[model samples]
Target: MQDVRAGLISAFHWRSDPPVWPEHRIYYADDSAWWREPTILGELGSSLAALFSDEPPTVVMSPESRGSLLGPLVATHLGIGFAEVRKGAERASDDEVWLRRRTPPDYRDRHLEMAVRRSVLRTGDRVLFVDDWAATGAQAMACQQLAGDAGASWVGAAVIVDGLENSADRRLLMLRSLLHLRDLRRR
Candidate 1:
């Protein structure tokens, strides 16, 4: 875990400009470096393992940014299937629901999508929502709504980091932060 953390701090130069804010700092970069850190990858995998080992067995996520990179890794770690919420248009007509995410001010005007493509949740399937980070939590709320609409049992939420100071929302059963902003503060 330390090695992964080291790689991410170096790769993203988190040491220089650690994304620490009085509130949430949802990463400053939107490039590959944000998702390429070894520590982040490992921490993501561990987060998945920790969450999936609990009651439920399935997971879903909203895609297009950090979640796009995170969803697959969590799915692979949990040995279960993963689905991405699509952005822009309605690609499917039936058997799926659509939700709009109001991202941070910086990500305003950007649309994010999350969907279940192959099979809808059956009678006893458990669903977990995973995202890269939590800032204002608009994205996470969108994901929770999607899970509810799908009729899947909502387990909880797991994140690479929880930038929000007050995280008392009920939807999150188990919340985990891989490497916090303080862990990467500028020296």
Candidate 2:
């Protein structure tokens, strides 16, 4: 993960001309935190599928953020079910599955909020988390907390890129970006 994080910081740029953002505000709250390249996203999805090829995952819990788009692609490639974590809404008593989200200070929401949705994970269930990028691990940890609360076993996080130094290093089962600073600097 350390190598992956260094590669991400060196290769990717947050500021791009003409700006590519999603129609939904939740995904791209700010230009600083989203991955907009379609090719990269596709590659990331494929990479995620490859990681689990040995024992292909069965269910994927995607963050309600930008990663949702890529998560489905990965899930489809792996032939699994995809569950989204939606923010600012309450699910029915039976439907409610609580997940914590540690939003960065600049996040549009301006505060931490828990995403609630229909429970897709049952006690002792194995689940994977998919996200576009990871900077501080807050979001990932939050998801872990939610998964723990729901009695689901956390498989790990798969991301397009991770900027935090050593963020993914030593993580038992995480997959990250293929490009590093050297790769991005040339592009």
Candidate 3:
């Protein structure tokens, strides 16, 4: 875990320019470095997998884009299947049920649709949601809703970095991450 944390910290890049939102004045942590190297991703996946080892997950679900990358790696390490939540209605199948999700401003601040084949997620299956990062947790909440719709049990959520501030809702969910935003903030 220490090695993975060190690698991520060393590879992380803090942007000099502030975000459009004044509240987000701290530089954004560039995540490309972690995605570029297989070793780093594997280490992250391994660490994430370890979090749920006691109660292994039956399926790993992730949203489109970065989640598509890290989710599979974690599933591979855990020897489980992976399911993808498509980004839009266009990618959804006519036969599948589409769940619409609203993301916070930090994550494009738009509504996105996600779906999983009914056959892919079965009832009673334990699901672990994986993503590269979580700030306001809009995406994770959507994924959880997706799991709920499918009747799968949400085991928890795992991510590379967590940026959410303390909140009552967050306290109710089991969210694990290798690093927090404070860990990467420019000091």
Candidate 4:
């Protein structure tokens, strides 16, 4: 885990040249380098799962792309199941019911619809959201709402980067990360 944190910091960068960010945001972080390293990749799942080992989730969930990658790793480490959440979904099938919600403005200020199959979350399921980065709690909140809609309890979020600016949002999401955004800068 320590090595993973060091690897993440060494790999991270804050960029402002045509950065992909909202109007009010200053710089965007580039963390793709960390994922390319074998050592970091090897330790990611177990390290992330250890963040909530005291009260491990019954199942883990992640949004479309990145989350789908990390969520399964954590679930595998903890011997739990994983569910991949869909984005901008209506209904996958006539027989299957999906719980979907429109997210609040995200870091990029884009409003997206997040969805998950209704059957994926059973009543009393302890759900934890897993992702590579979390600049805004919008997606996590949307997923949490889906969990509640299905009578599952939330167990907070686990991530590699904690870029959230709002303290209230952090508390509300119960977010934990391997490194904070400020730590990426040269010390």
Lowest lDDT sum, 10 consecutive residues, model 4, at 17-26
**Weakest 10 consecutive residues, lDDT, candidate 2?**
25-34
Write one digit per residue (lDDT tens) for candidate 1, span 1-187: 5555565556554322444774654535332575665555666566555655655566655456667777777778777767676545364567554544433332354445544443544434576667766665656666666666666776767765566555575235445555565655553
TM-score rank order: 4, 3, 1, 2
Best by lDDT: 4
Please report, as a residue range, the 10-residue window in candidate 3 with the lowest summed lDDT.
97-106
Q: Which prediction has the highest TM-score against the true structure?
A: 4
Model 1 RMSD in angstroms: 5.4
List pairs with backbone clashes in candidate 4. Answer: none
Model 4, span 1-187: residue lDDT tens: 7888888788777776653656754666677876798888888999888888877699998999889888888999888999789998766568988888889999889999998987777889999899988888899989989889989998999998898999999999889999887788843
Which scores higher on TM-score, 1 or 4?
Answer: 4
Model 3: per-residue lDDT, tens digit, 69-129?
Answer: 8888899998899988776645344675555554444465766556566677778889998
Assess every candidate by TM-score. 0.68, 0.64, 0.86, 0.90
In candidate 2, the residue pairs with backbone N, CA or C atoms under 3 Å apart (3 or more residues apart, or in different chains) clash, namely: 1-168, 1-169, 7-180, 10-181, 11-181
Each model's C-alpha lDDT?
A: 0.58, 0.58, 0.79, 0.86
| Models sorted by lDDT, best on top | 4, 3, 2, 1
Q: Which stretches of candidate 1 lie over 4 Å from their true place?
A: 14-31, 37-43, 92-123, 170-174
Please give the RMSD of candidate 4 to the true structure. 3.1
Q: RMSD per prediction, one decimal?
A: 5.4, 7.7, 3.0, 3.1
Q: Name the runs in model 3 displaced over 4 angstroms.
A: 18-26, 91-93, 96-106
Q: lDDT, candidate 4, residue 170? A: 92
